[model samples]
Target: MFKEFKEFMMRGNVLDLAVGVVIGSAFTAIVTKVVEGLITPIVSLIVVLTTGKTS
Candidate 1:
């Protein structure tokens, strides 16, 4: 039972899932930073220009 459990834990599919989770977390942080720091300000500026007030 221990050997079987170890094999299951070390399988390619399990490793792939771990790697995917890590990469997805990193990608979400990058996209969130870009949207907040760059896109949000630009959008706010455009909104102010069009409506005379910021959203």
Candidate 2:
């Protein structure tokens, strides 16, 4: 059982999947920050300009 588990862990697909998940998580965080910092503010500015209201 232990040998089987070790073999499974050593397989390329498992390692690739782990790496993909980590990279995807990091990318998601970066994208979220960009949206909040840049896109969100731009959108808010456009809204205020069109509506002439501040909240």
Candidate 3:
């Protein structure tokens, strides 16, 4: 069972999928930060200016 599990993990497709998941998570984090740091503030400012309320 252990050897079979090891072999499964060692497969190229499994490794590639694992790497892709990690990279995708990292890219999501970067995009999230960009939106929070830049876009969110601009949107908030526009909303406050138009509606005269803070969200």
Candidate 4:
């Protein structure tokens, strides 16, 4: 049972999956931050233009 487990972990597929998950998580965070940054400025500009007030 220990040998079987060891062999399974040693395979490339599991390692690749772990790497993919980590990279995907990082990519999601970066994209979310970038979108928020861009949207906030545009939305603020729109509000200021429409309301004629800067808050």
Alpha-carbon RMSD to native, per candidate = 1.4, 1.3, 2.0, 2.6
Count of clashes, each model: 0, 0, 0, 0
Tens-digit lDDT track of model 3 for 1-55:
9999999999999999999999999999999999999999999999999999995
By TM-score, who's the top model here?
2
The whole-model lDDT of each prediction reads 0.95, 0.97, 0.98, 0.94
The global Cα lDDT (0 to 1) of model 3 is 0.98
Per-candidate TM-scores read 0.82, 0.85, 0.71, 0.64
For model 1, the superposed segments whose C-alpha errors exceed 4 Å read 1-3
Candidate 2 residues 1-55, lDDT tens each? 9999999999999999999999999999999999999999999999999999877
How close to the true structure is residue 22 of candidate 4, measured as C-alpha lDDT? 100
- For residues 33-55, could you state the per-residue lDDT of candidate 1 as single tens digits? 99999999999999999999854
- Please state the error at residue 55 of candidate 1 in Å: 4.6
Q: Largest lDDT belongs to which candidate?
A: 3
Model 4, global lDDT: 0.94
Candidate 4: list runs displaced more than 4 Å. Answer: 43-55
List candidate 3 segments past 4 Å from native: 1-7
